[model samples]
Target: MKIIIISYQKILFQGNIISIIAPGYCGYFQILKNHAPLISILKNGFLKLELESEKKKIKIKGGFLQVKKNMVIIIL
Candidate 1:
């Protein structure tokens, strides 16, 4: 899946991933390839991205996320 993360400052990240774990408002949630369309309010925590060779994590104070057609857009 593809993901783009943008903030007021600039685009934080844009990449392909095997999976992602996001800090949801209620708790934390994981989105893998072929996830259903969704929109959620995020919380102060980290977004963990599992890439081809390694894993990465991005810290977010808060944001909104949308997933559709295997694409993820995150706005902060």
Candidate 2:
């Protein structure tokens, strides 16, 4: 799936990822390709993504996430 991570300052990441794990308000959750639609509040923690070649972890202050139709958008 394609995912984009953006903030007021800039776009942190924009690419196709195999999976993603993020810190949700309640806990942690993972999103993979073809997964169901999701929307959630995020907490201060890390956003982990599995790309084709590597895994990346990005620190987030706090934000929210939206997933739909194989696309994920994270605003921090």
Q: For each candidate, give its TM-score against the true structure.
A: 0.97, 0.97
- Clashing pairs in model 1? none
Residue pairs with colliding backbones in model 2 are none
Predicted structure 2, TM vs. truth? 0.97
Provide the global lDDT of candidate 2 against the true structure: 0.96
Q: For candidate 1, lDDT tens digit of each residue in 11-44?
A: 9999899999999999999999899999999999
Residue 58, candidate 2: Cα error in Å is 0.2
Off by over 4 Å in 1: none
Model 2: per-residue lDDT, tens digit, 1-76? 9999999999999999999999999899999989898899999999999999999999999998999999999999
What is the Cα-based lDDT of residue 37 in candidate 2? 88
RMSD of candidate 1 to the true fold?
A: 0.5
